[model samples]
Target: MDMDVRRAAELARIELTADEAERFGGQLGKILEYIDKLNSLDVSGVDAMAHANAVYDVTRPDESRPGFGLEKALRNAPRKTADQFIVTKVVE
Candidate 1:
């Protein structure tokens, strides 16, 4: 288990202290044990689902609405051209 933990850490490019490796190894063992228990369960009758509860879109339908005009939108800009805000170039 400790070796497995160390290998996993190496693959992940993570540096774990001796204490952390020991702790994580024990936790990983417990997780694997739980997974084994789950695998033993008969799940042939259960349907796979993405979520535990039913999910549905609850959003309002899109509707066209008047937007803040360019003048109002650019009113707070520190620097602006006639029709657009002037910001420093982010990319070459």
Candidate 2:
């Protein structure tokens, strides 16, 4: 299939030099040709999958642990409310 490199570049909002456009046009043509070849394949009974390999979460279970008390946690604050940090108002 003939590819219009200039039109494709314009549609993609990419500015390419004349030499670069010619180079990319050939590369894009080859990529499309490969896609066409893949489209010609058949796998009527194959199950759809996101990956060819098995995937699993390798994370540890979430477990709560003891932590610093509220007073200790806020000991270094320059300004404080009864149970919160006091900072300058941000919005006008």
Candidate 3:
């Protein structure tokens, strides 16, 4: 068992204990069998699917509204000038 396990591990370039190789081989065989069952299904007429089939409400009349962000916007700043945020000078 150790020789077979070691040889298989060497062929795959993986380090596996004697127990782990046997364990993984059984698990992998089951997964491959499940995939084969899925491949046997006939989806000959089903269309390739997208996430959802629906249209969104996208059209609305634009309206003019007064904005209200002069005071609260600059309240947390260390420096502000005339209803605008004052940032540090970058150019000399």
- Model 3: clashing residue pairs? none
Q: Candidate 2's residue-wise lDDT over 1-92, tens digit each?
A: 56899998899899999999989899988888777886677978988899888998798668887798888889998899987889999999
Candidate 2: residue 53 Cα off by (Å)? 16
Model 1 stretches astray by more than 4 angstroms:
1-15, 61-92
lDDT of 3 by residue, 1-92 (tens): 12355676799899887789878778776777677786788999988765577656797679867675778767798987887888779999
In model 3, what lDDT does residue 63 have? 89
C-alpha lDDT score of every prediction, in listed order: 0.88, 0.87, 0.74
Q: Arrange candidates by TM-score, highest first: which order?
A: 2, 1, 3
- Candidate 1, residues 1-92: lDDT per residue as tens digits? 13499998999999999999999999998888777777788999899999988999898769988899998899899999978999899999
lDDT of 2 at 2: 62
Shift of residue 35 alpha carbon in model 3, Å: 0.6
Where does candidate 2 stray beyond 4 Å?
42-92
RMSD (Å) of each candidate, 1 decimal? 8.7, 10.9, 14.4
Q: Judge candidate 2 at residue 15 and give its lDDT.
A: 94
Better of 1 and 2 by lDDT: 1
